[model samples]
Target: MHDTDDAHSEQESSAIHEPRLWRDKGWTARVIKNEDGDGWAVEMIRDGSAEPALVGPWTMGRNKVDPKPLDATAHQTLVKTASEVIRRHEQQLHAQLNKQCSIETESGSLTVRLVVTPDEFEPFGTLTAVDPFGDVIATVKVPPDFKLTRTRAERWAADGFGRIQ
Candidate 1:
């Protein structure tokens, strides 16, 4: 869905020569090539529900006249270049939202059922457990990006049960 207008704006925003990839730490990335000029472009990905934040042209080599062609090395390099951008953005976003919650109890880890009801009046998540008795044991509001990993699930299972705080 991107066109020339978007490209111009994205490049203008990041107009300085970033010699080191890790110098900027406020963006995430996807390495790409500008089809028009056959040059490399790094699409800066940002944290949250928003789409790609920025996109810009990258230098080719020492000459600077010919842009670097997008290949596996270039792609990986750009990804490495933007790693800190993604990380710092994620940290800032997490700090602002404070989006983490867990419940420990004595029985076994109950599944967290995040009930996202947009009632206009009560705009919140009803994070309850998917237990057999169908009782909503706990509730909290967390960012949508939060996830329950398999390893954590295994740990919860190992404990055999308890309400987490």
Candidate 2:
């Protein structure tokens, strides 16, 4: 009886959680708008997963008009919805957080910051602005660039540019 109960609990637990595999499968998470553009859609990708699963778009609920912007709550909901979709289509995935690089580069006399995130959907990598100085810039999606070297980082700082890369 104990074994049966334990097994039941395991099943119930599995029903709710999915391992993050998008990172390993090279799939990236993207939020798209529904046909109406008033809702959101979550997409999962990989070299080979079952048919594309649709993780219903989050709507503005009852407003029947402009959809709300995705915030932390929306983001968490999307992750759960999308993870469930992937679980139904494939085995547990082993996704990894994208590796990141904060690089400093110079553009003339000014300082520039570059950040990159590597993921499956973006098999190449991403680039973005970290900062010119003194503040956190917008978090953005970027492709990773291995070309960013240490010399470039130091040179950039000396050149008067700082990077969040």
Top candidate when judged by lDDT against the true structure: 1
Q: TM-score per candidate, in order?
A: 0.30, 0.27
Using alpha carbons, what is the TM-score of model 2?
A: 0.27
Tell me the tens digit of each residue's lDDT in model 2 across 1-165.
Answer: 799899767655543222222222223344456766546555544425554454556455356654444444444555566667767644423223233245534532222234334456765433233454645443333335544455654554554443334
What lDDT, from 0 to 1, does candidate 1 have?
A: 0.50
Residue-level lDDT tens digits of model 1 in 20-121: 332123344544567667766667554342665456776666676555444545545665655666678868855543322344446644565544434456
For each of the candidates, give the backbone clash count: 20, 15
Q: lDDT of each model, Cα atoms only?
A: 0.50, 0.45
Model 1 residue 89 CA deviation (Å) reads: 1.7
Count of clashing pairs, candidate 1: 20
